[model samples]
Target: MADATKNPIADLSESEQLELSKFIESEQQKVKLQQAIHQFTSTCWPKCIGNIGNKLDKSEEQCLQNCVERFLDCNFHIIKSLESTRK
Candidate 1:
């Protein structure tokens, strides 16, 4: 019997292996996306939200939208800035 702790991939058929690889890749992508969302919310919540209400007011909602846009813009700006210096 194969050890329970051993790599299960070794016992899988080629098709099963391919499916497992694709599943793992998708799961990893989901985890990365979830992490990014958590980071974005954490960073934006304080800057955009105020006075813990039952729901977000329109102003707060707009603030969060703008914050995320600005954050993405900042990331792109930094990437461009670095590329310019590398030349």
Candidate 2:
């Protein structure tokens, strides 16, 4: 039987490892962004939409825009507060 605990990434050179790490981190950020967008849409959809319309009326469009803005503002405020606490 062969040992199964080895990591293949450990075989790469230092530069290669760093590059792979950065690439992985970039991909993770993209995934997180996508999840946040989905969550934003999910939360705001039912709140602003009452029926399946051909297109969004002006009020519905405004509501969605406001919802997204508020969501972003809340997240930014929380992040800033956390950073201040860490300092």
**Best of the candidates, lDDT:** 2
> lDDT by residue for model 1 over 15-64, one digit each (tens)?
99999999999999999899878878999999988899899999999999
Q: Report lDDT (CA) for all predictions.
A: 0.92, 0.93
Top candidate, metric TM-score:
2
Worst 10 residues of 1 by lDDT: 1-10
lDDT of 1 at 14: 98
lDDT by residue for model 2 (7-68), tens: 88888999999999999999999999999999899989889988878999999999999999
Error of 1 at 44 (Å): 0.4
